[model samples]
Target chain A: MSQTSRPRSRSGNLAAEKLTYAAMLTPALLLLAVFVFIPVALVIYGSLFDFGLTSRDWTFVGLGNYVEAFGDDVFWIALRNNLIIVIGSIVLQVGFGTLLAAVLDRGVRLGRTLMRTIIFAPMVISSVAVGLIWLIILDPNVGPLNAVVKGVGLTPPKLGWLGDPSISIWVVLGIAAWQYTGFMMVLILAGLQAVPKDIYQAAALDGATGLRAFWYITLPSIRNILIVAILITTVGGFKVFDLIFVTTGGGPANSTQVLGTYIYLQAFNIGEMGFANAISVVLLLIAVGLGWLQLKTSRKA
Target chain B: MKVLGTACVVSLAALAIGMPAVAADKATVKFWTLKNPGMAEFAAEAIEAFKEKRPDIEVVYEDFPNEAYKTAIQVALNGSEPPDAFYNWVGEDSARLVREGLVMDVSEYGTEPDGFQSILSDGWLSTLQYDGKQYGVPLEAVSKFFYYNTNFFAEHELKVPDSFDGLLQSCRDIRAIDEDIVPMPLGNSERWKLNHFITMLNERVVGHEAANPDYALEADDATLFTNPRYVEALQKVLDLQEAGCFQDAPNATSPELTRTMFATEASPMIYCGSWCAGIFNGEGFEDFKMFRMPEVKGGDGADGTNFLIVQGYQISAKSKYPEETVAWLSHLVSPEMAVRYAETMGRVPSNPASLDSSDQLTESFKWIAKDVSEITVPINVLDVKLENTVSEAYLDGGVELLNGTLTPEQVMEKVRETALKAKAKLDK
Candidate 1:
């Protein structure tokens, strides 16, 4: 009788656990199904047809849109611009962010809190506001930058900051870095704070001092955090639209046309929904691949 | 429990009794327009007038910003609900909507002898027609004119240019007076501003008949956009840039900023739309004078071939109340409302009768309306008339052309490539 009762209680506990887990996961799975998977499925399916924004005509094109985008010069230019932005963001945002985090964590003692707050301020501001403020600062004719340049007995660039096709992208990248480096720094600073203090004592005992200690111990210890920072920057760069849209409008001869803006232009401006969807699918894949890399790296760490 | 159950039954009974009564009493028509400075007041006035005419029909008017209106209208039209009546350009935009079956014909209401067709001319009516079917009612017409600062011209001793060569000479003279001052401030960052110049240039150089084929891309693949004169027209724009007529960074500056420069006398001249008179008036810079674009040298284009764009209202095909929508639209555009439109908006009302009594039509605006009436070739705005793909290419080409990165020939080659692709798609 005791053995039978024990088996019955065990079975009852198992049933309750299974019910709890199922109940907990249903809402999350439903949300993912509704918000993410369904939309993605629609985008992937719709990409195979020639559809317009308002038009009900959906002609079966069978990858025609993708082929068209591949052949399209603007598409190529947008992809190239997106690549530039990704690389620039990694170099500027991650590199400077890590440096700032390190300095705040160990180097500066007097104004660490103030510097951290100031650096993190831009992250709080909306990208659109950032773009507007920068547009005025970069205006060729009336901007204070030009006034200052002239005041210093130097002529500004003939096309101003955002006017030159060759240099406008770099200006945009700089503006992006100005806004995002703080966010990355904050993220990395948290990681640095979580690092064990005993590691530094151990490194000093091993005669690895200052830069050598930072390189061998501090850098390796913050590897996961740096990867996180890079993953964020990479995804953010790919998804960049508002800043570029509000600033240069992907213009000066489509020189600043990135994938995000290009997708918008095709979908809304050009009324090519299928083509935009195809480009968006490619963008989604790149983001997913980057995300997978991040996950794999994090798992290894 | 009995009391609560009884209360619930009473509420359900009340709702059942009241629902149809509310639904039957009024037909609300959704109306959408791009947000402008005085448009809200003007729409309110029209709706007020409309209310007196049709008491049973309630109109809901919503305004969206110009940049967002394109996507808003498209999405609204495609979604479960669409505006009953909406603003649209009378060209490829509305034509595409009409083709998509998103726009109602409204032919009967528009062609009513006592309706909008009676007040508007056949030509204005035809602007909204596609495949011999009317899809819209032309409400207003806009045309480009050169707005020059009177004080600047007086101080510089510059006479109004009457020919293409004279215009270039005027630029040279103005630049020579003060090399620092921009002779003309053109903001092509939006791209449409430069496309305006190309539209007039194409007419001036390629003429209507010759350019029409290239514009329509009806020519053979090898001959598509091969017209040398088209390249020359682009060259003239480059020539103006070389003459220091335009700012160093026209491609980056905004159209609004360009207007401000001309208004503040920082720039001596700015070619803008007739709608700019209202802006100039609002900005308190009324000391500006209007002039048509000067004639192109050795060109077959007719004189006074102005760049005009007609904007109008289209009834959504899915509107539940077509009769009320049409009636409300007719009342909105009636002779009485037209006067109010002119007074409030300072636009050239579609109804010719509005010109007789409008007190708000400034002298400069009056001059534009008169000048537009004299247009022989009737050159429509390029962005409105061209296919979407080709229009984008033209816009980018204008940017590259002004940036001095692409030559006229190169620009035309790009244009040809886009035009060929667009033509193939359109043909299909």
Candidate 2:
């Protein structure tokens, strides 16, 4: 064929290729609409109505749910509890996980795989089971922890760790930290391993050694992974329910009730579907906002 | 490429065609229940009975642990494929269901002349009623009664207290021997557990006497909580706590732990419900006897009264076969079924006529039945929102009061605040 005729043939091929790409994308777009977008839209829709357990008595009271939620003291308490969990998990999980990963990276020679498995074991177990296990371990009268405390001549420990309103949140936070730290450890370890050794050598050449070397070179290298870990941990912390539900039961007197459990109570217990949906909408907004901020900061870095 | 696309479409079509054939065949009835060992056995037998009666029907029983059962059942009901029939706790949970139209009105089944004898006690039937419609069959009766360690009482030469002061004196005498041995092991952890104590005390101390003549438990008036008798009754509970009559770390101790302590004779007195009769018997404790809690001194109508809580079955509104579901519920409350359930579960029957003065009845239960025939008002069934909000406040306030964090008045104030919020919600 002549060169001009060949060009026309290529153009036809390109057009056909574009049509194929569109055909391939259609299924995924349809799935997203069915599963993700539709449910989210429904949640937003439900938030505008007064749905309950038995009755479909939905009425459009504009922003009434949001107003009620803002006025409700329990919602504030739950929100505060969520904040505590988020901060606690970020500090204890990512912070400790990174430290542990760094220590392990320096080469502890004794059964490394076994130790890693042991640390990661809790993460693999279901959250409900983990909560139950901790509940027993923290039992005031029968738990071995109290027995050990007494054995050491401590005044017989009388604190109901999980049942006491003052201390239940801390116990719950500790359980969350315990189960998830290993997960963060694995993530941070992967990030640490990916850092080129040449950078460390360069740091050493500049008289930065040990702790200073880690602060200057190592942290910068794994900044993205840390940010990712924070993002994941933050969302996980905010959404925590199974562990708290099984362990403290949002007692003594709703002391440990977080936003997730509160939303559940409003929907199922009190049968305030509209109020629950409002809480969920707020949660979605918060999650998106925080996630966006994290991504933007990571991109800037 | 055109050939490939056609083949893919043909396979998808074939798979879609085959999907319905693999779908469930039998008329499936989704059933949800709290996981109880005895209840599990009872459920199995009932399922067998149901299947025998209707061979075409199939049941899918979903058992959840008791703690998560309430939330799970609620969530499931909200889902697309909700259960056809399910078990529900009595009081506000059932009331909310009935009010919301999630439960079927079983008045037709209950009010039938051929319905089970005493199929609905006036007391239990009241709980199932919302806006003058019945929703469930009474399955079990539970109430706070005084359970004493017979061995301890005998060893101490103590008789069952006839009056409220006498009961306090008994506690004092018991505490004189061992300070740690609380006469009543009131654990504040599960706040609802304390409600039993509070309700029982209300019956004795207030004796249903209202300062305002219009103060009625069932009335729609907002002045119910303002009764002086209610305040006095709550104060008495706080008094018991102040007297060191309850265990330390009341909120920390589980009901199981408290029962274990009583069973082991660590504590001499425990106020619990008739449902625990099975528990004590299962533990093979021979030295236990129950009695009606003593009346408060100088209270009107304080002669004898006992609080009653009932557990029952309800048909779901979404049931495909409403008639069949109602038939099963009617069978559940029949005299034959009631006797079998009571005998199996070690609980008293809701049917007054079923009490044939049988020797099988525990002595304490028999005595309470004979002397205290009046059924204390059920506070839990008054209003859905009110009950939950008040119960939660009662629990939290009880915990604080027991822990010396709040006074009786403060607790009452907090409860008032909670009640007002609930009332406002209901009004809206």
Candidate 3:
């Protein structure tokens, strides 16, 4: 009788534990299914058809839309611009952010909070606001930057900073870096602060001070945070829209066009929802690939 | 628990019973328009006037920013609660809506005794018609012109250019006055500004006979947009650039900034739409004057052929109050409202009969009104006239053309290639 009772209690506990797990996960899984999975599935499904946003009729085109995107000149230009933005952002935001974060961590002796706040101020401003501010500052005729450039006896870009196709994308990249670099600095700075002073002291005894200590101890300690900073920058870079939309509008002959704006142009402006969907599928695959890479990297870390 | 449940049911029942009665007394006509300066005020006036004319029909008004309005209008039309009557540009965009069956035929309603058709002509009606059916009530037209600073011309002792060649020489003369000055600061950053120039140039150089066919995509692919004069029209724009008519970086400049340049006397001339009259005035620069896009020597455009985009309102097919919405639109475009429209918005009203009666009209507004009345043919703007794909090519080409990155032949080559694709797609 005692052995039978013991088995019964154990079974009851197991059932309760399984119930707890299901109860915790159902709402989250339901939300993910509704918001993420279903939309992604629908997007992929829509890519196989030719349809307008308002048109009820859908013509199945198989892989025709994707093939069209591959052949599209504007599509290639937009994808190239996106890649430029991604790489430029990583180098400018992450590379400079590490420098600034290290300086704020130990180099600067005074106004630490003030410098941090000033550098990070742009991060708090909305991207649209940032774009508007930059637009005014970069105006060809009236912008002070041009005046300053001329005053310094140097000629500005002949087609204006944002007007020249050769240089406009780089200007946009610089503007993006300006907005995001400080945020990266703050993120890395927090990670640096978490690093113990004892490690630095030990490194100093080994004749590893300043740049050498930073290279050995300071960097190795914040390795995971820097990886995260880079990951965030890469994702944010691909997803960039409002800034480019507000500034160049993928213009000066589609020179500044990115994948996000191009997708919008096809879907809303051109009314080619299916083509837009195909582009969105490409973006989604890139995002998934990046996410998987991040996951693998985290596992290695 | 019983008392609370009973109270909740009673409240819901009261709401349900009251809603239909309220809806019965006043059928709502949701109206949408692009948000421009003074447009909201004009729309509010229209709504108020509509209430007086049709007391039973309540007009609900909504407006969106000009850039956002295009997307908003399309999205709203596809949504569950679409506007009953929304403002639309009269061209390919309006035609596409008709093709998609998103808008109503309104032919029968528009032809009724109190409809807009009674006051409007076949030409004005033709602007919004597809397949001989009127789909909209013409509100106003936006015409393009060269707004020259009167003081600048006066100070420099310059005559207003009358021919396209004269215009180029005029740019040279102005630049001669001040080599550092941008004779005409054309901000083509958005690309439409320069496209507007080329649209008028194409009409001037080749006329509607060659363009309309290619524009309509009825021209055979071999000859599609292959007109040598189409390149000549782009060449005319390039000629302007070479004469130093524009800034070194025209492609990067904003249209608004260009407008301000003329308004603030930073630039002496601007090829601007008639709407600039109000803006230049509002910016406290009233000593400016406008002229038609000067004649192109050896061109086919008639003496009075000019840029005029007929913008108006269309009733949604999904509207529950189509008849009432049509009435509301008709009232908005009536002679009395047209006068108020011209006075309030400083636009060229469709019906200018009552414009002289409105003593509130600006001298510039009256001048534009008289000039618009004398127009022989209104060439709809190319960006709005052409189908999306071709228009996009034109816009992008305009940017490249201004940037000096693409020559006239290259620009037209790209445009022709795009037109061929668009024509093929349309043929299918």
Candidate 4:
């Protein structure tokens, strides 16, 4: 085999190898065409029409759905809520995640595995379970949180945690932070452990140590992982549905409605498939544009 | 030995995998309903009697929870695996299925001798009709009212209020028993609970005939939801809230929890559906009585107008076994099954035949049946009555109304805006 891999023979096998590779890639390409590309094209096409899911008649309005979505106040509220969740998840989840990862990396030695496992346990649970658990905890009537608040001298919100319009979205954000911060921590922790220990040791020979070692050695080393973590958080924030669906259900006059839930409301609950597709297309474009911007900015950096 | 064992396993596995869904001679008819506790059992019993009548037909029963049932039925009807016949509320949901040509016109089947139409009254049969064509069988009607603990009412000397102001006063009188005693614990977290309240209130305040055009989305955009009485109906709900008729955090509490509250006698009153009678009885609390939502003062509604949500089954137009499906539905509304439904499910069956059987009707249900028969004007809940987007707005507006984030007028304004948008969309 080694003798057959001489330069002339290697050059001759290139076309055959290329053919084999094309044959191998055909299934994946077809799968992508069937699942991703075709559905996206259909969604974009459907967004231009006016139709119900069950109605046999489909009227082509040529961007009428997009027009309605833009003029719709609930659509704007949903977009604003999505942005709030993204920024807030990044700050609360990624920010605290970095700190926890750093502490677990070097500062804590005793029961390190135990602490990591405990901190990472919630990540194993589904978001729907997390939402239901927090729903009971934040419930105004029987939830322990309000009992504890009233036990002390403080007062809970008048309309309950998820019921109060002014604070329900923030409460949902906090719940998301609780459930997902552990995941971000584990991701960053993998990056931290991959940072060669000798680099920190060499830095310690100089003036860098403690918080300084973290700021320079740890953060800069895990920069790529941090970018990945932020990207994951942003995408999850935009697609958040189950938690908000189970908890607030975009209620108290839709103060907690995100784009995902609003799209579901338009599609399933209200039976406006075309209008829902328009909102979905808007979500898709925003996601693609932000992802492109992130990649470009990361590459520039 | 190993080869023989493998052959045995494969043959057994093949037998398990290729089992028939029903007897080879029987044609399967799919049935769907909401997942209430007793409904499945009652449906099974009915299917047993149906089997005795038609051994060649098999009924495959399925159910979904209330909210999911709506979406499930809609999507299922459009998909390849549509139900042979599915339970549905009798307003826009069923009518929309009719409009989309998804529901079968059982007019001929219904008009045959011993058909469901012959079994039920003209009014009961007409409730599920569209343009004089019968679309489905009317199984039952559920009405909402103030269900009070009989013992607590007697102890507190509380009378069932006949007027809206009197109801508020009743709330106050019950509150005097204890400040923390949620006089009537409303569970509006799903928003539909309050939607039911607003439905009757609107019926009482705006009158059904006047609000029908707006609800139907036939009124002009400029005049849609322009009735001042709509605001008054909202204010009535607020008035109940101010009177401490509900718990402090009604918008957060669930219907089940609040129903448990009333069942446990922690609360004396609950404005719940007629189905609560069965649930309360199942929970071992049977000392409960019912009364209609009181008429608002100076309102245009008639004396005996009440909330009557008619629900029934419609066959999918695309069902492969339409004859069997129609037979199954007809059997569902049969005299024996109607009695079973009333006895097991504690609802007012459209077919009142055989209700005189022993243990066929609970005392609480008998009152419901009498009131339903005597109802001068029947109004379905607004969520089922209104157009979809407008219904969504009404649901959200109800939550905001309870939250006090929006005043009654503001709530109506939001509803009016949504109605205008829905009307405009319809025109387009």
Candidate 5:
């Protein structure tokens, strides 16, 4: 009699609880369906057609857009640029950010807060504004930089840093690093703070010292946080657009064009909405795939 | 609970009743324009005039910075609420909008005798037409020309260049005097500015070919980039850079910077459009003059033809009050209005009746007009596809050439490739 009564109560409770949970999550679920899921579904759908701003002249050309994208030289160039930016950020931002964070943690005797604020100030500025400011600073004629170069008693050959396609990539990478290094440093510093000082002391007692202690104790302790920072920077690097658009405009002749700006140009500028969406789908997949790998590797570690 | 429920019901009912009534009583047209020092004032005056004519209609004027105008317009047009009437860059931009049917067919209104100038001659009307129908009313016409600082020229005792050789020699003389001062500040950073140079060369090389009935037919049938004239025109730009005639870091230098340099006499000369006349006027440049860029050697019909680019206004297809918008546009395109616009903006009028010169006009303005009037060939309208493709390649390749990374042939090849792709896409 007792077991039958308990089962009856539990079944009734489960029904009420399910209703309560649905009611609580209804708004969020609706929002996700409208904003996120629907747009992604549309992107996937749109990639199958050859639609533009004008006319519903879409023909269902399965994988045609993808095939064309692969063959397109601009796509390859933009992809190459994206890879360069990703690798550059990882080497410069992550490596320098970690080293800087460790140095700062060791307690520099200088104005640490002031240094930190100065380093982080760029991240606080809008990317567009940052691009413009750099454009002015890098100007050959009126810019003080050239003036300094001339003041050094050398005939300064006017370098179109942004105009020259060969050098534009490096300039853009430099800008990305300048803006993001501080952000990465802050993340690393926070992770460093979370690291237990006792662990380092214990390692020292066990004959671990200097670089050895950092290698065995400090790095392993903060490995998860570094992974998190790396994942964030990698995704951020892939999605860079505003600075590139404002500074170089993917010029002097589409040389500095990134996938994000290239997608924008394809969709809005060229009115190739379907083709642009296909590129976006590819970008999204690459990002997701990379992020998944990072997470898996971190978890295994 | 009853009181709260009652308040919600009342508010919802109020909103429901208020919205349609507000929307119906007065038609509001959102207008976007580039920010200029005096444009807001002009827009305000125009709005007042519009309001006086149509008491029931209201205009919501929004202004954006010049640099942000393109992105802002694109976003605004695609947004939940779009402007009814907006400023647009002419040429490929207008064609894009017209093709999309985003722009309204004001043909019925524009063709009306009193709505717009009936005397819009075949050549004049052709500029605004897309696929045989007018999509917009031509607001202003501008021709690219060489603006020189009169004081600098006088100081250097250099005459205005009338031939290609003379132009090259003058550049060398200017360089010899002061290497720091750029003889011609051709800024390649803004790709369009680079295109200005290319357009001038095209005029010199192709001559009447751009306006030729046979030329368009030929272009439609085959790629225009493969043509000898196209490569010859591109070569002239590369030649100029190699000669060290242009400013250092041409790619990094923007139009604004170039203009500022000219205005301050830092650079002796700048190749810019006649729209810059107002800028010079505003800057109180008392000793600035302009002349036509010299003709290229052995170029066909390379005489007096000046390159004319037009910018205009169009009503959006999605506009709520199409009639009112048409009425406003009609008033703006009238002879009196065109003259006013020309005077204020320092632009040439498309209407024949409004071409009267004023005493306040600069010497360069008169010279350009006289030169254009005497030309046997009409101003060239570049094929939209070839224009963007070649322009971008020239800009990108121009920098590399200047930096010694790419040779002239490579630059031409890159341009040819882009032009071929654009032709293929356009042909489809």
Candidate 6:
């Protein structure tokens, strides 16, 4: 009788522990299920149906939206623009961020704190605010930049900085670099400080100083942080919407259109829910794939 | 006995939660409108007057910015709690909503003596009609025209263009007189500005009767938007650009900034809406004159055909209190209130009776209303008439054309492709 009761009680205790764990996780799990997981599932499901936001009738067209998106020229243009932004961001944000971090970490001792604050100032400002600031500065008719250009006896471009379609994407890149480089710098700066001082001193004694020391000693130490920064930028580039929205609105003939804005136009402006969802799915896949690749590379490194 | 008592208590609590905790006597009507200058003040003044008539009906008003309002209204209508009535452009947008059974037909209330049918004309009411049923109350009549600086025209000895060729010549002459001045300042960055130009040009080239079927996408697929005249209208926009009528970067300028340029006398002329008269007056630039688009020589367009769009309130089909909603919307468009709308908003009221009632109406506003009334065929703006996707394509095409990135043929090709796809989707 004692042996049978002992085993039963142990099983009962295991069940109670399981119940407690579920109860503890219920709030957070429920929130994720309601807000994030449900919306993602709905998007995936909606991508297969042709419907509008207000349409009472929904027609299931399996893979039709994806096929249409694949054929659409605007989709291709948007994808190309997204890749351009991603590559440009990695080069400018990561490349320049490392340089700034090194300078602040080793070279600039005087007023370092002040310079650091000033460089990092734009990160706290919202993207919409940053876009508006840049818009005013780049205004063709009455902007101060144009006034200065004219004052210096030079003709500003006829279409202004953002008006020219061929160069507008690069202008966006430059503005993004100005805003996000400091964030990357601060992130990298933390990793730089964590590096052991003895490793650098040993490398210097072995004649690996200055640029050589940075390449051999400092870079290898912060490898993980650099990978993290690149991954963040890569993911962020794919999701960029608000800045382009406020500044260009994907205009000057759709020259600045990225995937996010294109999806918005299809969904809200054109009322193509299924097509927009299909585009959203593609965007999600691209972001996820790039992220996975970055993680695998980081692990290999 | 204990279970029964607990059940009774729960039932009572549920009933109490469902009931309004307020006076429970007043009916709240949620009213929504696009944000415009002075609209809040105007709505407040109107609401104050409305309270005198129906103190029991409390109107909860909300305003949305123009860009977001289009999406917000549709999304709100789909939600469980929608506004009792909302503002809408009375064309394809309202027609789509009506077709989807999202708008309530207020015809019964509309026909009452004090309702909009009696206050507004039959033709005006027809603007908001789909399938022979009225779905909206027409509030304002808006039209676009060339707002030129009288001082600049007088200084340059430039006459108003009365023919298509004359308009082009006028542009050349303006550019010749002052190379620095833009002949017609266009803000196509918003795309609707170019749509306005194209809509009038379509009326000029194809005439209203021929353009209507195409505008409605009722024409056969092969012939749908295949008219050479449609391409010709697009060419004319490029012609204006080539003639140096517009600024160098029309595609980059905002409509508000362009309006400021004209009001400050920076630009000599701008094709602006009737509402701009109020803005010009407010900005203290009263020295302005207006003219319609010149006649397209050898085209099918007739005199007195002009661009006219009617905007008004639409009742939600899901409203709990349709009678009160209709009553509130009707009261807003009543003659007394229409006069206030015209006086304060600087728009021509749909109610003709409001015209002579408002002593505060500007001289320019009065003339514009008179001119709009004389138009035999009032063409709906292209953006409002065309399907959403096609309209977007047309808008984008206009930008590309202005930017010199796409030629007339190329723009038409792009428009045709999108129109075909949109028509296919609608058919499905």
lDDT of 5 at B135: 79
How much is the lDDT of residue B109 in candidate 1? 77
Clashing pairs in 3: none
* Superposed Cα deviation of residue A9, candidate 5 (Å): 3.4
Off by over 4 Å in 6: A1-18, A148-155, A291-301, B1-24
Instruction: Give the TM-scores of the predictions, in the order they appear.
Output: 0.96, 0.86, 0.97, 0.93, 0.89, 0.94
Please give, for residues A228-301, the per-residue lDDT of candidate 6 as tens digits. Answer: 89989999999999999998988777889999999998898888899999999999888879879887977875
> What does the i-RMS of model 4 come to?
1.2
Residue B212 in candidate 2, Cα distance off native in Å: 12
> What DockQ would candidate 2 receive versus the native complex?
0.36
Off by over 4 Å in 2: A1-20, A153-159, A294-301, B1-32, B47-63, B72-85, B106-114, B117-134, B207-224, B300-303, B318-320, B351-385
Q: What lDDT tens digits, residue by residue, belong to model 5 across residues A1-301?
A: 9988998999999999999999999999999999988999999999999876554367787898999899988898899998899889988898888888887876575988788788878989999999998898778778776677778986654466676677889988999899989998988888888888888788888999877877887788889888887778788888989999999888766778889999987875566778888899999998889889788867875
Predictions in order: lDDT: 0.87, 0.73, 0.89, 0.89, 0.75, 0.88
Please give the ranking of all candidate structures by DockQ, highest first, separated by commas: 1, 3, 6, 4, 5, 2
Q: Cα deviation of B171 in candidate 1 (Å)?
A: 0.8
Rank by lDDT, highest first. Answer: 3, 4, 6, 1, 5, 2
Better of 3 and 4 by DockQ: 3
Model 1 chain B poorest 10 in a row by lDDT: B110-119
Interface alpha-carbon RMSD, every candidate: 0.9, 2.6, 1.1, 1.2, 3.1, 1.1
**3 or 5, which is superior by lDDT?**
3
Residue range B1-428, candidate 4, lDDT tens digits: 99999999999988876676435568999999999878889988888989888999989999899878878887888899899999988998898889999989988885566678778889998898889998988899989888888898887777878788999998999889888888898877788999999999999999998899999989877788998999999999989999989888888888888999999989988999988988898899999888888878899877788899999999999988887888888888888888888888888888876787747577888888888888987999999999998898889988988888889988889889888878887787
What are the fnat scores of the candidates, in the order listed?
A: 0.72, 0.47, 0.74, 0.74, 0.57, 0.62
Q: Write the per-residue lDDT of candidate 3 for residues B1-428, one digit (tens) a residue.
A: 99999999999999999999988998898989888778889888888878787899988888888778888888888898999999999988898888888999888885677688898877788888888888888889989899999988998899999888989999999989889888888888888898899999999998987799999888888888898999899999989999999988888788998898888898899999999999888888999888888878898777778898999998888999988898888888788888888888889888888888988888998899898888898898888889788899899888888877888899889888988987776676
**What's the TM-score, to 2 decimals, of chain B in model 1?**
0.96
- List-wise, what DockQ does each model earn? 0.78, 0.36, 0.77, 0.63, 0.45, 0.71
